[model samples]
Target: MEANELLRKVRKIDIKTRGLSQNIFAGEYHTAFKGRGMTFSEVREYQYGDDVRDIDWNVTARHNHPYVKVYEEERELTVMLLVDVSRSRLFGAVGEEKREMIAEIAATLAYSAITNNDKIGVIFFSDKIEKFIPPKKGKKHILLIIRELLDFTPENQGTDISVALRYFTDALKKRCTTFLISDFIDTHDFTRQLQIACNRHDVIAIQVYDKRDTSLPDVGLMRMTDLETGASRWINTSSKRTRQAYSKWWYERQQSMSDTFSKCRVDHASIATDEDFAHSLMALFKNRGVR
Candidate 1:
């Protein structure tokens, strides 16, 4: 894309996502993702309902009164977005390409993180680590990230979730709330890495998919290319057997994906290309809050 066009799209996404982060998300994001731990704030007079363990006996003895050490949730946290920028992200038969949806979703998450006074970072992957923006705070940092999300292109075209997850655990020393956004179309098994990462940090999976990806239209023979491998083939989509097989494959794939998440205890939600992503996101946040 041209420089001017990229800037325009980035600005457009910033406006929409920033508004959602501010108005729609509001306290939901904070409530869903609590801090890693709490920090001591100050000492105050012990109240009737205060926890007895918090009583500062030294201060009580010196002042001849019961004083409790006040602590607040350490709101400062780091949010990491592990984004898949593979070839499949360009596929869509609906409102927007998967890539476009991903850019918007990443921007929204980044903006939401900033609203909670947290640091936001991103890892763009395409069978490898395409780029990594170190966690940082401020609107300027978020804008830069949005700009990169709009314009940064990857060198490879394949999908490998394991590579990305491994890099995330190795590079980021501190535990963080991480969002892994992708279509979950990987040939390699990354459940082991995902389980390991979840042990160290809170990880959420946001699977973006298109309705057409699950079925085929009866439009006779159609030529298709494997975006990741660059292989081309012709399929007789009008055949009942072909369509049935494809539909069955999709169902099994979805079930396996759900099982992987359940086995690892990872929170996840799937969003279709034409669906109302805002509602799905709100639901996911609400679910996490209740947990």
Candidate 2:
């Protein structure tokens, strides 16, 4: 993309997602992801009904009266977006490509984080870690991340969720809220690594999908090619039996993924290119409250 085009895309995303973060998601985001812990603000004279444990004996002795320490939630947080840039992310059958949707969703979350005065970062990964942007707080940093998400190309074409998880765990020693965004089409045993990562950091799986990935239409015979492997094959889409078998396989795959997420105790949500992702995200936020 040209320099002008990149700037235009970044500006467009800023306009759309910034308003969303301020108007729709600011409070939800703050409530869903809490601060690290409470920090001592100051000490004041003890009042009725104050917690006895919060009383400061040293200050009470100095003042010859009961004093209580005040504390507030340490609101600063780091949000990491682990995005998959494999070839499969390039597939989409509707309004926007999967990659485009991923970028938009990432931008929305980044904006929300910055609005809450939290640090935001990103890790673009395929089979390997393509790029890592360190966490920082500011609109300029957020825009840089948005620009890279829109333009960065991966060096590899395969997906390896395990590698990304391991890298994230190693690099970020402190706990952070990480969003793993991907189509998750690769066959890899990431359960162990994902479980470990979740133990150390708060992780959420955002699975992006297309309608065609789950079902096929009876549009007669069609040629299909695997995006990750560049393999081509012909399928008789007109045959009812073929469509049924394909649909069954797709459903089973989805079920297996869901089971894995359940076993790992990770929160998972699915968004399709043709659906309203904002509504789905809001539902997910509300559901998290129940937990």
Candidate 3:
């Protein structure tokens, strides 16, 4: 993309996602992902209802009066976005491509994190770690992330979610709230990696897909290409049996992915290209906040 065009796209996303962060997700995000622990704020005079365990002996002795330690929730946190930038994300027949939707969602989440005074980082992966932008705060950092989301291309074409998850688990020592954004189209088994990552950090999965991915159009014979492998094949889309089999395959794949997430005890949401992702995201946030 041209520099001017890229800048325009970034500005546009910034405007839309910034509004969402301020108006819709800011409160819910803060409620869903809490800080590490409470820290001491100050000491206050002990009241009749105050817990005896909270009494500050030093302060009470110094002032010759009852005092209790006060504490407040630490609200600062580090958020990571593990994004899949594989060739399959470019396949979309019904609406916006998976890549486009992923970018928008990532930008919205980044804005939401900053609104809560949390640092945000990104791991762009495609069978390998394509890029790593360390966590940072402020609008400048978020704008840079949006720019990269819109323009960054991966060096590899295949998808290996396990590699990305393993890297994430090892790279950050402190527990972080991580969002794994992908289509979940990898053929390799990543359940073990996902389980380990979830055990170490708070991981949420967002699966963005196109309508065509679920079922094929009844347009007679069609040629399909595997974006990642550069393989091509012809299929009879008009045949009822063929269509049914394809749908079944897609459904089974989705069910398996859902099962993996459940086993890992991770929060997740799925959104289609033709659907309003805001509603799905809001549901996920509300659910997590309640928990």
Per-candidate TM equals 0.98, 0.97, 0.98
- The residue-by-residue lDDT of candidate 1 on 134-243, one tens digit each, is 99999999999999888888999999999999999999989899999999999899999999998899999999998989999999999989999999999999999999
Give the alpha carbon lDDT tens digit for every residue of 186-264 in model 2: 7888989999999999999999999889998899989999998899999999999999999999999899889989998
User: Candidate 2 — which pairs collide?
Assistant: none
Candidate 2 regions exceeding 4 Å error are none
Q: Pick the lDDT winner.
A: 3
Colliding pairs, model 1: none
152-185 per-residue lDDT for model 3 (tens digits): 9899999999999999999998999999999999
In model 2, what is the error at residue 191, expressed in angstroms? 0.7
In model 2, the Cα lDDT at residue 260 comes to: 86
Worst 10 residues of 2 by lDDT: 282-291
Error of 3 at 11 (Å): 0.8
> Candidate 1 versus the native: TM-score?
0.98
Return the TM-score for candidate 3, rounded to 2 decimals. Answer: 0.98
Task: Quote the RMSD, in angstroms, for model 1.
Answer: 1.0
